[model samples]
Target: MQKISPCLWFRNEAEEAVDFYVSIFPNAKKGEVLRSGESGPGPAGSVVLVNFELFGQSFQALNGNSDETFNNSVSLSVDCKDQAEVDHYWEKLIDGRGKGLACSWLKDRYGVAWQIVPELLPRLLIDPDKAKAARVMAAMMKMVKIDVATIEEAARG
Candidate 1:
């Protein structure tokens, strides 16, 4: 049991977002779904909250029923083990439903931002060799999705 989990806020799109997320992650499982009561916050029987697990991490989403939106300030970061892993997640997350941006950043259909980063990225960036680290950073900055080979090549220079 994790001490704390992320609570996502959405405006009447909690279920849809959860569904989309579950579809993308192979290690995902759908959990309990709670609906609004007759007392009427939303229409009775409408989904108010949903619980699920993604890659063994628990998440809860609420139908906030507000105009508020998700911004880049908070984004889920996936540390991919390799280029293939990075590519897999980047394409899967986008897949015409999302838009990829600079430096492995992307926004899914629900406007939730994600970072499909290679695990090697941070390691290379923090290397004792400042010149190689700077090269890796330069290469990564111009990339839409993180490329492990490019990062490795930069680190070698």
Candidate 2:
């Protein structure tokens, strides 16, 4: 059991969201699901809470309405090992309905923000050569889904 897990609130789509998320990650799995009981806040037998794991990270989804909603302020960052990994995740997460944003940020179909970043991104951004780092940043700024090759070429400049 994990000491702390992020609980996401959905408008009665917790189960669906969990399923979608698990399908995207190879290491993800569906865990326990708790349905609302009769006379509860939600309809009986409807999903109340769902437990799941994505890449070994435990998370819970709640099928309840709240004053708050998901925003770009919070996002799940996926550190990809290579360009292929970055492409895979970016495509999967932005699956038609989701919106791709600048600098490798995107929102999934469920409105959850995600950052599919390559492992080399940070190193390039923090390169000892300020000119190279600036070039990399400039290249990154123009891209929605980051291209590792472009970043590398920019860094080499």
Candidate 3:
């Protein structure tokens, strides 16, 4: 068993969310679906929770009858290899459901925020010269995820 797991609370779309999430991540898998029982907190036979994994991280999505409270404070960060990978995820994830901002922040239909960032960001931001890194950080602060090329340019300047 994994030492840590992220438990997500959905209004009533635990199964659907799990399916969508599994489809997006490369090594994702839908493990099990637990239904409410006679002694369960939910109505008997109704889907209560879904167990799944995304990029090797295990998660549990609960079908709780409550309002969703997902915000920008907590977002899934997708470390992409290049612009193509970032674009693909941005297009598919944003689709007609979520709002897309410059640099790579997007909110899905479920109101979950995601940062489609390039894998090169850290290397560029942690430059030997503090001034250069600071400039890059300034540029990144205006962005959500971050563009690899833009950060590189900022670091060079």
Candidate 4:
């Protein structure tokens, strides 16, 4: 169990969100489900919260009847090894459900934003060469998911 886990509040799609998330990440699973009270805020037998894990990170999906509030302010960043990994996740997660933004950011079907970043990007950019970093940044700015090969090529150029 992680020390700190993010709890996502959904209108009424906690299970659906957990299922979709688990399908995207390799090490993801639905943990536990919290049922609603007999006569509380939610009806009995309804799911109030669901514990889920994605890539070793714990997360809880709350199915509370409230306003849907999800933005790009706080996004889950996935460290990918190469372009193939990045592309795989991008295609699976996006799935024509959410909008894709440049610079390795995209919103899932539930409006949750995620940033698919390459593992090699930081090392290549932080090589104590500001010019090379700037070039790589420029190339990365035009991409939805940071491609390691493209960033490496840009840094060399």
The superposed Cα distance between candidate 3 and the true structure at residue 87, in angstroms, equals: 1.4
lDDT of the candidates, in the order given: 0.91, 0.90, 0.82, 0.86
Q: Positional deviation of 116 in candidate 1, in angstroms?
A: 0.5
CA RMSD of each candidate after superposition = 1.0, 1.2, 2.0, 1.3
Candidate 2 residues 47-156, lDDT tens each? 88999999899999997766567899989999999999998999888888899988999999888999999999999899899999999999999999999999989988
Superposition error at 103 for model 3 (Å): 5.3
Off by over 4 Å in 2: none
The positional error of residue 37 in candidate 3, measured at the CA in angstroms, is 2.3
Question: Candidate 3 regions off by >4 Å?
Answer: 38-40, 101-103
Q: Which ten residues in a row have the lowest lDDT in candidate 2?
A: 62-71
Best by TM-score: 1
Cα lDDT of model 3 by residue, 1-157, tens digit: 7998888888988898888877877888998899988997778998998999988888899888897678788888888899789878887787677787655789887777888988877666787888998988888888764666777888888
Q: By summed lDDT, which 10 consecutive residues of candidate 1 come out lowest?
A: 86-95
Structure candidate 2, residue pairs in collision: none
Off by over 4 Å in 4: none
lDDT head-to-head 2 vs 3, winner: 2
lDDT (0-100) at residue 106 of candidate 2?
97
Residue pairs in collision within model 1: none
The local distance difference test score of model 1 is 0.91
